[model samples]
Target: MGIIKLTNIRVYAYHGCLVEEGKIGSDYRVDVSVKANLQPSAGTDNLKDTVDYVHINRIVKEEMAIRSKLLEHVSKRILDRIFNEIPIAEEATVEVSKINPPIGGNVEMVTIEMTLHRHNHKQQSEL
Candidate 1:
């Protein structure tokens, strides 16, 4: 197994519980990591056989564009799409950070992280 990571994807998005936050928006940083079997691609040297980072980046950008009340909601949406769209991805973790969040205090950022495994998703569906 191997992992592909896309880090520090910056975007301007409107995602927060505050009304002012929705209108004014804020800066966000997103990171996504996906695990998959890399032996096939390593041997074949073919893009089709591996988890493509470009595809992953596209997913992050698309999901982050949507408005949500909380970072957790956006993080879950990103994970769900990764598994649904990238069939080769066995597991994925996403971190969504709100830079200079409005929670009051000297905080650098507020981040929400979520991890999902393909098997875990299957089990949830069966339930």
Candidate 2:
């Protein structure tokens, strides 16, 4: 088992609990960690054997484009997409940070992080 990390992907998106935030939008930074069997891809150097990071990035971007009321929802969407679309991924962690959040005070950002295991997620949901 090996880990693939993609960090600090910046995106401008409209996602917030507040109405103004959704209207104006804000900058967001996303980080994703994927755990999988990377040995085959490492040896064969084939894109098909491993998770395509470019495809993951595209997923993140696509999810960010949609409006959400909370960062937690955004992160969940990203994690779900990664696990469902990337067959090689056994687990995934996603972090979504809203830069300069509108908290009416001095705050740099707020981030939501979620981790999901393929087997546990399905079982937990069914219960």
Candidate 3:
């Protein structure tokens, strides 16, 4: 097993409970990490044999574009799409951060993180 991580993906999005946040938007940083079998791709040097980082980036961008009240909601959506779209991804974790959040006080950011395993999803589906 191996991990592929895409870090500090910057995006401008409107995701917050505040009305002004929806209208003006804010800067967001997204990080995604996926684990999969890398032996095949490592040996063959073929893109198809591994979890594609480009696809993961696209998923993050697409999901972040949608408006949501909380970072947890967006984080879950990102994880769900990673498992559903990338079959080779055995597990994934996503971190969504809102830079300079409006929660008062001197805070750098507010972040929401979520992790999902493919097996867990399958088990849930079977129930």
lDDT of 1 by residue, 29-69 (tens): 99999999999999999999999999989988998899999
lDDT of all predictions: 0.92, 0.92, 0.93
lDDT by residue for model 2 (1-127), tens: 9998999999999998888988899999999999999999999999999988999999999999999998898898898888778988999999999998888899898889999998976786689
Specify the poorest-scoring 10-residue window by lDDT in model 2.
118-127
How do the residues 1-127 of candidate 3 rate in per-residue lDDT, one tens digit apiece?
9999999999999999999999999999999999999999999999999999999999999999999999999998898888898889999999999999988788898889888899997886689
Q: Number of clashing pairs, model 3?
A: 0
lDDT for predicted candidate 2 compared with the true structure: 0.92
Give the residue spans of candidate 2 off by over 4 A: 124-127
Model 3 TM-score (2 dp)? 0.95
Candidate closest to the true structure, highest lDDT: 3
Poorest 10 consecutive residues of model 1 by lDDT? 118-127
